[model samples]
Target: MEPVAENKRGLMPGGVAKRRFKLSAGDIIFSILNYIFFTLFTLICVFPFYYLFINTISDNELVRTGQIKWYPVGIHFNNYISLVNVNSLGTSVLVSVGRTILGTSFMVAASAFVGYLVTKKEMWGRRFIYRLFIVTMYFNAGLIPWYMNMSMLGLTNNFWGYVIPGIVAPFNIILVKTYIESIPSELEESAFIDGAGYLTIFTRIIWPLSKPILATIAIFGAVGHWNSFTDSMILMSGKPELYTLQYRLYIYLTSTSNLSALMNSGGSVNTSVLNSVLNARTVKLTVAMVTILPILLVYPFMQRYFIKGIMIGAVKG
Candidate 1:
């Protein structure tokens, strides 16, 4: 006997047919254009790093003559060794690592605290305070005046220069403030009812919930501190020991046209290896990679938080 026809509709999960929306020709065209535009944009953004990476690893002759392209030509790792040969490499690394960790931590905490306080309607002169910070975003004192201020404050030649100046970033504060305002007011009210003080409510409830925004701002602070060269150049000019990695890298890049001269001039590692690979261009590319790798590595770990925080924090209170 022939089997009965199957009830295809009832057999499907949810027992309901999925509805499909037909797109207009215009919609399809718009989507296609959007994809094309973004693909090009992504390539534009990514190609520089790709070029830098390939050039750094490619043979010196290939990089100099513009022969290196999509892939590395003659694989060379000596550019990295040249970077390691610098005498102050260890010190610069320590300075950069220390400043990044300390500065980012302080900035995140202070900015969040200030942001939370500004969200409190009970606070007096809150509008004025907020406006004061916002105004700084648009205007700044000239370089001379700023340098003089740092000099007067004795921040010159000091490690605190890196950490202190960034502790209360106005933009990060605004981001946190907007995000905090988005949080339900009843949460704070309920905490108050349970006899939670402002500090307790902040540490226990606000801080925990504010992780996404904090991580985003922490990334900003870390990148800023890590890549900061001008600050060290200006503030620690007299103190070579206080020089950061970026500052040292800056000096290396600008100090000479000849890679061999620059490498042989100071640094403890006067190896034949560095001498063999003495391609200034590739060496600079290697240094660039070293400088950016930490931040790039960090992005993958914090990417989820960053995307979520930016989207949510952008919402108006």
Candidate 2:
């Protein structure tokens, strides 16, 4: 008998034949088109930040003339170094970071607890309370009344002003509620049968299960708190110590004198050289980069949860 012919494709260690899979022509074309589309889309989204960064690091004179684009030219650290001269820089960073942490925590906790409470059939006036929350999303008193309320509550010029008002965000609560409703009710029932209290069920089972939505709301809260300067602008008018990073950046943008003073603070530098390489434009770009970098750094870590949470939470709503 003739020896059995060997397969052109070699067998695996387990003696399973390795199959070669080839993409169809349509699939290959579709994949190429998808890659091209996404590549262009990514570039579009990223160019603004890249443009800002390069302009900040590039020669201020060249940047001012609009010659610097797509890459750095005659790069120097002066733009960054000059930022140290802003007396409020360190305090503003601390205030922004502190508020982001505290505010996000408070918002997430409030959203989760309220979200969970509203889902229960046994909770008193759950429907009316939930409807009230929904109603807040559609209506608001004007800025004057809002400010008066804050002043009456004595939140004016207070750090808590940044955090407390954001605690009952109806939108976030709705997202959390929708997501929580998707959780299996059997899990809570089982916990209840085992002598678990409502608080225990929430802390142990519901909270852990709801991590995706919680993280989503956390990202929202963090971004909102980090980017918000209007509240600080209105409430902390006389209190520079409580001014957030965004508010400080706004002040710098609107005040060329402030930027000039900061640039001049670079000790012992030749006045002409400072004037040449450091200007309001470069300073503004550098400040923008600084303000946005933290959030950019943080968003990647939570992106998976963000997408998942938003998708699941939005499914019902």
Candidate 3:
């Protein structure tokens, strides 16, 4: 039997039956042992999430009374119910969604343009420019400088503060550049000879051909934006209305005496200390679900690109 390329119903190019990856007796035994170990590993990885799910929606009374330790003793909707009533939290979620979308779009566009430029042999100062961006990834400016810069830029208390800061990833630019380099240069040359400008070639040829890698970038940047809290925590001091969901949830969970005060911000009494713990748990779950859902949903579509991009990027200059 030939070792076949998946999705193509054919043998190896030479048509000789392809080499097979066969197992010896010891290999078979080890393979089985590895699978069993990995199965247990997988279960271990998922078990914590299962615990979180069950405990999050569990009755607080049951949890406090020690009737439930690892799983829900009684299911109740109040955990989610309490969360649904907070204006600041709701505002935060919307802001986070907006920030993720807005920041990702900006990142994609900027990275795309920069990546295209960096890939061109004709561009002067390309090496310098690429290095300039890449250096920041290794040595970041301190937090105080970043905060003061934001203040100087008047991004403080502004919704754009969170959305604008992270749009250009030097690493992402490199990834896109590498993937673009993998594309046959002849097509671009032909486009250039046919009177296509950089914008036209990029918009017409590169973008459509590069959707898979773009999707990969979108997933990366969007997850970063969605999970981000520290920047918003530092910068968005005055604007409760503009707080990202993660930051608001962090404060809600950590602020013990302020639960009632936070609850009152929305004119909702659903945040008493007893109920707030449950809310905190639900917030944890909600954040887990929300942060992951987009990546999970988009993953299937971009699987090929996700793999191909790495392969393409790995090729030496």
TM-scores of all candidate predictions against the true structure? 0.83, 0.87, 0.80
Q: Using TM-score as the measure, which candidate wins?
A: 2
**How well is each residue in 146-207 modelled by candidate 1, as lDDT tens digits?**
99999999999998998898887999999999999888989999999999999999999999
Q: Which residue pairs collide, candidate 2?
A: none
Between candidates 1 and 2, which one is better according to lDDT?
A: 2
Per-model lDDT: 0.86, 0.88, 0.77
Weakest lDDT window of 10 consecutive positions for candidate 3: 4-13
Which of 1 and 2 is the better model by TM-score?
2
lDDT of 3 by residue, 19-89 (tens): 56877999999989999999999999878767666765777666545566566777886656666776577
Please list the Cα RMSD from the true structure of every candidate, rounded to 1 decimal place: 5.3, 5.6, 6.7
**Alpha carbon lDDT at 305, candidate 3:** 78
Between candidates 1 and 3, name the one with more favorable TM-score.
1
Question: Which residue runs of candidate 3 sit more than 4 Å off their true CA positions?
Answer: 1-24, 65-70, 257-296
Error of 3 at 128 (Å): 2.0
- Tally clashing residue pairs in candidate 2: 0
lDDT of 2 by residue, 149-240 (tens): 99999999999999899999999999999999999999999989999998999899999999989999999899999999999999999799
